[model samples]
Target: MPVIRPRRLRQTPAFRAIARQTRVHPNELILPAFVREGIGAPVEISSMPGVVQHTLDSLRRAAVDAADAGVGGIMLFGVPAVRDAMGTGATDPDGILNVATAAVVAEVGDALVVQTDLCLDEFTDHGHCGVLDARGHVDNDATLERYADMAIAQAEAGSRLVGMSGMMDGQVAVAREALDAAGHQGIAILAYSAKYASAFYGPFREAVDSQLQGDRRTYQLDPANGREGLREAALDLAEGADVVMVKPAMPYLDVLAGVAASSPVPVWAYQVSGEYAMLEAAARNGWIDRDAAIAEAVLGIRRAGADAVLTYHATELALALRG
Candidate 1:
């Protein structure tokens, strides 16, 4: 005699299927792609078994497949052959990420949204998000200038949405003003509003070939705090973020939900490489069913009110969900 009668939907598979309000679709998935400089084949990351660091050719092929699967978008990151103190490569029109973005846009055209990472870590030898000051700390204002330049570069290279993942103060305003002043007002900004400093990014370091001298504790959100996440999102919204994101989606579902509930624009969540690898490793160990786990994780994010999810297993999950 339960007041809610929750068992009504559990009567049968057909009933559960028919009554389901939450669903996973290919158009809700966004694949994270990596393009390295002058590589011939895909290089697998040890921490993430099935994921790879893609060469241009491989990246193009994978993008084609994802587009064919009807994914919502592709998020691009670069691994440059050279790095410097200010991450100068990031702002170069001919840089690895910019060139790759152009290439992917040519390959996919209007089929999917092509997003570019507007950050410095992949281009800096020191692996910080910006130029180091006299004391070797990341200079926020200098970094903002660099981000503005990178925003222009990304827009010029055919990126539809620029992913601002550095968690820098005033990044959105800086980049927005830069892009607008350059007459690239069509370009959108997807801010990593609540990116936390967590152990979850360990695999991404390997994926990006990072040479970071220190942690991102100063810029990224503290994992111990949840209210700070909302504050960051608030700042990003006030600064013209077209979309706001919460990184490492699983551990931050509440944050995602809170942000989505309050956000005026779309909310996205990233299933970081470490999250992908952990689930994959557990599946490989015969501890959990891979497909089920992937679907469940994705569904959980959807339930958390994410408009879209950036995931390493985006293609596979899309295929499975479609079937």
Candidate 2:
């Protein structure tokens, strides 16, 4: 009797919709955008088909679009025109990221959360997430000081959330302390708690024009270690992370699920550059249905217990969801 029964719900779209256990809402999706300094027009990332490094004007327009489409937030990553050993741009009040943050906040102030990427990779000449020591290794404690300064600058720029993606120890605590000291007690920290040193970041390197000569295995978690991800989340949580994220989420769904299960704060997953590129490449080659694959990918992350998702497809998907 059961052999014939399963097909009943599968037979109609309406029935399937009603039976669906997981859904991605526009309000649960955050768009990560890149705004490059010195660009008069938006430039497309060759590795990531639909994603672009925006000009100031385009960034404002994009923020407006994201807000109008009901996206919950937009995370801004700045591509500076120059890079320095100390990543001075990251802490500058008029830095590209800060300016973009101010522009976005002004464009859509209360409509959506404007977030900033509080990492040094895009500003550092070496393309490392932190300052390097005399020995050429990333200096952890020294980097935290930079992050603390960067957080206040972002808060001053009107960012509601500062995303700490540098994978440095005690970053959340340092940033929180600095922000509170500067009278920005309301700004929140979103820690990239379980980010792995994944090959999946290749496309992102291109998107940011990375100058990294070596891998970030020293700071980023190893892809093979699931338990370490949980440990990182716990550490970040204790350090005052308002939200914790798992990066390159598709390959780390198990880690994401584990964190989501135990985390007291909101848990987010990033469908990063490579994930976006893979789907776009496949769709371009007629190997997959773009919309269906995107919907499924995001739904899987949501089903894995992500409270929110950072995706390159956020705006388009949000518009589609509305229809």
Candidate 3:
């Protein structure tokens, strides 16, 4: 019998490049940014090393930088100076998020997609993703009403895409209805369909100065249920989600793959704060190659079926890819 050697394709860089099944492009990366309402300067998040909460001015600069580097989009998260029980700021025309959205859209609207996080967790006093009832539980219906209003606010503020990350039932449908009714039907919805209540969200709490005293297990998916994730994706798709996302990407790649395989719309993955922190910490300690590890981690998400990846490393990686 003739000898068979698959190793022939692994002999050179050109061969490896030609045989590569997956590629990560600069335009397939989205940068997630935090803009604080009252900050005069950018505040570096301790847990998330290089990630920062930006002043409005700094956020504009960052958006310009991301656009210049050819990043696909920027997901804006706002930290308001005040929080009320109803999360009034989330729907306020002059609220931090709305203002920041307008600013970024004006700065980079022509260059990149400007997306906004349409969740109440950063605006509510209790740090929940929705309004709470008298019983201190998240009120799904009331929150849906709030999300409907938020969608309009974000749309009016020039956000091309509104990310519904609250995990509330019927949220996508409600937001879609409201946006259409308000004649902002051009604004797309990005549903955080398979977002899990993972421990990896710790640093994000600090980035937004979260008021969460307990957990969000009531709404967010449980890490143990992979099948449940697919159900959520189906529901979001039926409700008119333009894009479905699997958050905390690395930990739930199996879930991501399942969603990508079935979803007709684009599927995205979020490399959450914890994932970024772990790799950064190891690299700082000399336990790994920083650039190589970051690239591989994002590439793995892409290989697992993410059409695009939301990452804090988007700007740097995009720059490196272009370089």
Candidate 4:
């Protein structure tokens, strides 16, 4: 050991900071927001402590805040006053979500990437994503038609990105064709290509007032099957998805890695509501250090090959990192 100088750079904060391979920035964090119809005031989600079902006014304010903070984007999901067989409220120009989309666009303009959840579950009375067949089972083909219409409506309302989250067969292709035919060529699709049938979506049920009677196994991928997720991502990409995503990101890091490894489009991950709530609850009770745990959650996702993360804690995390 003739003066190897192994400690040359270990003595300085600047030196250690310079060694960061993966960084989480405001631009790398996408915030997911929810809005409700006919709500006079903001309603906090019990399960997701810090999250709220914002009124139209509050939703706009949050959107503006996120945009002002330079967050990558704001992903909006609407909770309508009505639900029906066709999820009619979802495509209505005056529907809560569609209205919120326009409001966000008006508020943020191009300062941020305004995105909307292009799914019927939040609007459907029966909690299915599409029209039920004669047997009452979800009809995948019929669902695609509805998704196509949703894509157009969201784009028309000035949403730059439509998240195809219904897990319907051929949804991305159908939406793409519909958008092109309707002359919405610039609208992008963020396909939730590998959304799983997981317990993590439970808290989301309360967030959206979902009336789901049964599981989404008919469409959503099974959690036990990792290879199937790859197939689904492949299908979404071939169908013209501008980006592909894996839901419940932490539980499926391997799937996230696999999708990112081969996806030509950017691969994103959603740290779903349950994941967020659990961490928050634990940190609240002093089971873990809140800031450190939050940082680890995000860092783990980024390390798993996600180009971007859709997180509920996006704004705070960005601020924490900035400090």
Which one wins on TM-score? 3
**Model 1 poorest ten-residue lDDT run:** 1-10
**234 in model 2: Cα distance from truth in Å?**
0.6
TM-score of each: 0.98, 0.98, 0.99, 0.96
What is residue 163's positional error in candidate 3, in angstroms?
0.4
Q: Write the per-residue lDDT of candidate 2 for residues 1-323, one digit (tens) a residue.
A: 46668778877899999998898899999999999999888999999998999999999999889989999999999999999999999888888999889988888988999999999999999999999999999999999999999999999999999999999999999999999999999999999999999998999998889999989999999999999999999999999999999998999999999999999999999999999999999999999999999999999999998999999999999999999
Higher-scoring candidate on TM-score, 2 or 3: 3
Candidate 3 minimal-lDDT segment of 10 residues: 1-10
Better candidate by lDDT, 1 or 4 = 1
Worst 10 residues of 4 by lDDT: 1-10
Write the residue-wise lDDT of candidate 1 on 7-52 in tens digits: 8888999999999989989999999988898788889989998888
RMSD of each: 1.1, 1.2, 0.9, 1.8
The segments of candidate 3 whose C-alpha lies over 4 angstroms from its true place after superposition are: none
Order of candidate numbers by lDDT, starting with the best = 3, 2, 1, 4
Backbone collision tally, model 4: 0
Name the TM-score of candidate 4.
0.96
Q: Where is model 4 more than 4 Å wrong at Cα? A: 1-12
TM-score-sorted candidate list, best first: 3, 1, 2, 4
